[model samples]
Target: MSQTVSDFIVQRLHQWGVRHIFGYPGDGINGVFGAMNRAQGKEGEIGFVQARHEEMAAFMASAYAKFSGQLGVCIATSGPGASHLITGLYDALLDHQPVLAIVGQQARNALGGHYQQEIDLLSMFKDVAGAYVMQASSPAQVRHLIDRAVRIALARRAPTVIILPNDLQEEPYESPPRAHGTLHSGIGYSAPSIMPREADLDRAAEVLNAGKKVAMLVGAGALGATDEVIAVADRLSAGCAKALLGKAALPDDLPWVTGSIGLLGTEPSYNMMMECDTLLMVGSAFPYAEFLPKEGAARGVQIDIDAGMMSIRFPMEVGLVGDAAETLRALLPRLKPKSDGAWRQSIEADVATWWKTLDGRAHQPAAPVNPQLVAWELSPRLPDRAIITSDSGSCANWFARDLKMRRGMTASLSGGLASMGAAVPYALAAKYAHPDRPVIALVGDGAMQMNNMAELITAAKYWRSWRDPRFVVCVFNNEDLNQVTWEQRIINGDPKFEASQRIPDVSYSRFAELIGLRGIFVDTPQLLGSAWEQALASEMPVVLEVKTDPEVPPLPPHITLQQAKNFSLALLKGDPNESGMIKGAARQVLETILPGKQ
Candidate 1:
């Protein structure tokens, strides 16, 4: 029997260093699976992971790329199977991660004839991968298409697609594959550092030197330049405020480091931005322009590798288009150290007071578990090298504010898209990338039920393959969309409609057990520690379902008068859920306005 096109595709993937393929079996892609079976026992052969759905497969693939810094690959059959991969593919594209998706099409002759399970997969994926979507029209084009898709995804940090027709996949290959140079194994397709122009560097320094008070806003792009960023901040004697995505960039223990700077932010960060006369933004294109300094209130100097993102959020006085570390290094030599440390000292003092205040709130005793306390108790218990993922909702707020990310720990969230149901996939991918380390996911009941609960079975299926069985999923059973409900009350001046915002009761821990995994449930604060210990000690995947108080609102660092007015209107609307709203407001207002805590 002669080799088929599917065989060549698998060979090309092996040469490019793919170790895992996340997908589900289907008739449209039966030929590809046949080739996979034939290549068993070969060196560098890929392992197949069976997912409950194609969307979960795509999410896992994207997260694999994020944690491992490798080209993540996903496979799906034609028609609806391929359509299900769109949302997760967008997740990768929005986060700027590299992912390659291979979807099966109908037989070559039935492509446009509306045959069974037939659809134009190319046109469907055009929006996501307009530049990189290709079809293997002939057997000779199989190898080249695979190579091009992988290279484009790696170099550009974007998603690429390859459509394989069912008929062509089983055809005999007539020509030899073109020989291409081996890919570099070190950093996998990273470009050289881009240095900024001397003139732009000088102008940035001039703006900083002219100001009496300065502040630096850091983002994820500055992760590699942590040391350089600290050096520049120390030289300028500037306070550092981190964007939510940059939460783990620097240690929170740093005296001058103010925490996150948006809705899920701290008072110190908000105050630092309000007082600074000059802002130095490094590798951060943080949205929410209202949180930033108003026009003419502060002079701005921005640094980013993508020139297109320059001045997109706030107007910059000097935009230095270059790599973060290199630009900071160039600007350091021409800058002068601030003669006064008073500004930085004051900011540090405020940050210390905020921590004490947060601790007091997190430890408050209540009927049900307080969400903030969950983060507080779990933070000290995690291993130094643990990987954590958070779902978007009120749970994310607690994780952002109360959780402490040390120097060695890594955490991820959907910062740009703010999507729910990513925690399950994120944790699975992290465990696959570093099987020896612990992986945890902090999710809400509302988010857990939203297309991610089924993923628990997927985790159970792959449990035996992991070297370390320290995977934990902490479920916050709040029974409501607490984040958006609070937003409706505070932003829209609308009362919470119980029917619409409430989530039906479901025991997530029981669901875990039914899927053949360890499960623990806690309804009170006293059992929080014991539940976590049990999870860590179990030599298998565990889900800890903690019944949390939905009444405790995740308040922002600062609130305007208009927001207060909206809450008052909700109270006057005579809704039955007004007491929780009133209590949350009182707690936040009293703590912020009263001076005794300081």
Candidate 2:
């Protein structure tokens, strides 16, 4: 029997080292599904992970690339299935992750006939897969399309697409003939050793050495260069701050390593940025300019692999385009050690006080439970090498500020897209990538209701296959879209419009129990610690739900005068929960000024 085009495409992907493909099944791509079925149980055959929705599948693929540092692949049928993947692909594109999307298209006979499920996929995918997008017209074209899509996605660190017509997928495979207009492509790609010129490194070092106070900001690009970042910081006696996506790049145990920097940032980080005389940004594109040093107030140096991203956030005296670790290694020798230790001492003191303030606030009383306490207690109990993920909302604020990361642990969320419904999928992909380690996801009720609940079924389907059975999804049940509610008060000066902010309260724990997973519900403050213990020790996957007070403010590290006025204006306009809001905000504020007294 002749091998089909789908068979050859699968074989080609395997040669390029694709281990798994995440997506849902559809008739439009039935040929590929048949190919995957036939190839199963063979050596080095790719595995298929079935997701509840195409969107979640795409999110899983994006996250798999992020956690495993490999090329992630996702597949779907024609039309709606293809459209659903756009959000997840954009997540990978904005975060600069390498991913390839393979989708089915209408049969060749139906082209331009406006047949059912015959949308123009190329036009739809052009923006997200702008690096590369192609359709296979003949069996000979499938090989190069697969080869180039994988190569380009990896080389450019962005998503690429290849559309296969249903009729073509079933046709007999053919290789391109050795003639003009025919091309042959091969497998394999390796990142080049990139480092800045010696002259550039010398200039960056000079800028650092001349300043008495130096500050460093690290992002996801610095994840692999942890040791190098530490060495540079020690030599310059600088305090290092991490962007949200780079939380695990430096351990919070280090005295001078301030926590997340930005709206969900730390006090020490805000102070360091405001006071430093020189700044060094490594592999981070943290978008907020207000959180950085004032213009012309500090000399700047930046290092990034992408030349386009270099020096865009802040004006730099020197911009070095290279891999983070290699560039920092080259720059280390030229840096002269700072003899005066005063600046380092001050930064350390501030970091220490900030932690104390956080502890005091966590211990303050709430209507039922303080959300900050949930994260703070989990910080000390997290197992070594555990992987954590969080959804975007008020819970992320706590995840950023309270959870102290240790060395050897990994964590990530929807960094660039900041999309909801990604936490559960991210955790699922993380578990598949590293089955030996435990994975936890911190999600808010809003995101849980959005689409994460259905993903719990995906977890139930695959948990037994994992070597370690400890996968916990902790849900903050606050009954409100707390982040946007607070944003209304602080950013828009509008009251909490109850209709939009309030969400229906569902028993997330009970739903877990119905699906054969352990469920633990906590409403009292005293039960929070033990609930986590019970869930982590369970033999099966668990959902730990905590009833938290929505009125508790997710206060920024530093509040501006305008923000203060806006908050006051919202209160004057009669917010629905005005009394509880006042009390929660006061208790948190008082804890900072009068520690342990609240």
Candidate 3:
């Protein structure tokens, strides 16, 4: 059978389980877009999404990957369109996401000449992709390259680029596929191996028997194995806390869950993990070596499915390469309870005390509204199975601390390398993939502006399709880098820094109304409840724009004491010439933290 270069690329994507592709049509890639359209109509496994910009297309693809645990696919034309995609691709790379980016190139014969939009794409994207490729002049190499690209993307957890020359896209090809990859259920996040060697279980049991004060620190890897993890924690009578990703694994409201660890991680979580005599690391390989306590004789039992990662980031005394849940289960039976265990109660009390202080840390009557109130307010309206998407920045850590995710409700993110404009598209994918479930987006004004706000239209389309409309997009209108500004006050001596000074005003409410979505704008915390009430009850996609102070403190990932001091200095040295912003911040913070005094 004869197939065009475009058809070959589209077909290969189907073979690799990619469904939705985001792209903008350009002259350089007209051939590929046509092929994509034909495949969508006939084959129908993959679908096309027209994007306003190249960056949005890549952002959508990256978010889709995290949501589905599959490689996300995006397309763009060569030259400017291709060039515009670099930022989004960088986002995908830094965040460790799997994405396949198809870009157009000048015709094969016109490569070296000064073509209108010629760029050294392969060389430019060398650092950005997990793998890179140029279109083959012949049909045979195209097939091989496509296979290699997908493998590299999935294996390395980064984006891959395939720049197609205009002529190659027009060429004809035919063949049966050479090979397909098989799944090894024992590895990766979804199908965690439950069976561990008896020796490992025995070792864990011995550790529990010897340790008087043990703490179990679970990470995202521990998800799906929550029950198993808890069972092990119970067996050891160990105090339990989580890494940020682990937030989805266990119920945050659970009395047994101590708190989350690391930067922006709760104080209760930090103290317990730091003070424990023996720490059991599960599912998560937290890269911050300094966040963990230095063990003398106290040891760590690290368990993960990825064998290579057992001690890749943190030193461990006993490295168990298997599923966290499975290893815990096997180990639980072999271990006897330790005598004179003081860690669990003491840690639990400390954690509870920290929770009490969180009221002071996050909540207070503020005129512009506290960011924490956004999540705390949004949670009650969402159904138990809602899917929440978070952007990086103050919103990311704020939502993490504020949102209470039940097991079925997923909180998807780009982890340590937080990307700002990913939430809207990610939420769109979740709504598309799980039509029955509700999806909410917690975004910052700065973040939402970057996504072009066209996502509202998509949400409206989704809402009309389902008899029950259950999507909400909430934008916290804090027109600054509130997180960074908090540090500026302490370190730079400038209490207020307008990090978002260049951003234009966003009348998100009016924009949502223009796009057929329900728009509810609130400037105060009190108004949030009513806005949320109406938003939750709306028959279509709803948008809640909350006017928040642009000077909130950051929800940091764990920072060193020295780093804290440096941040304080940044606040002290903050440009005093920007005193208006400083006063604005101090007022906002005072309003939220201390009322009636001023």
lDDT by residue for model 3 over 171-262, one digit each (tens)? 88644344564211111223334466777767766776777778788876777688898787877878877776677778766665776666
Clashing residue pairs in candidate 1 are: none
Cα deviation of 232, candidate 3, in Å? 2.1
Best by TM-score: 2
Query: What is the TM-score of each predicted model, taking all chains together?
Result: 0.94, 0.99, 0.86
TM-score of 1: 0.94
Q: State the lDDT at 126 in candidate 1.
A: 90
Leading candidate by lDDT: 2
How far off is residue 189 in model 2, in Å?
0.5
Segments of candidate 1 deviating more than 4 angstroms: 174-190, 594-598
- Report the candidate with higher lDDT, 1 versus 3: 1
Superposition TM-score, candidate 3 onto the true structure: 0.86
Candidate ranking (TM-score, best to worst): 2, 1, 3
lDDT of 2 by residue, 243-334 (tens): 98999999999999988999999999999999999999999989999999999999999999999998889999999999999999999999
Candidate 2, overall lDDT?
A: 0.94
Please tell me which model should have the higher TM-score, number 1 or number 2.
Answer: 2
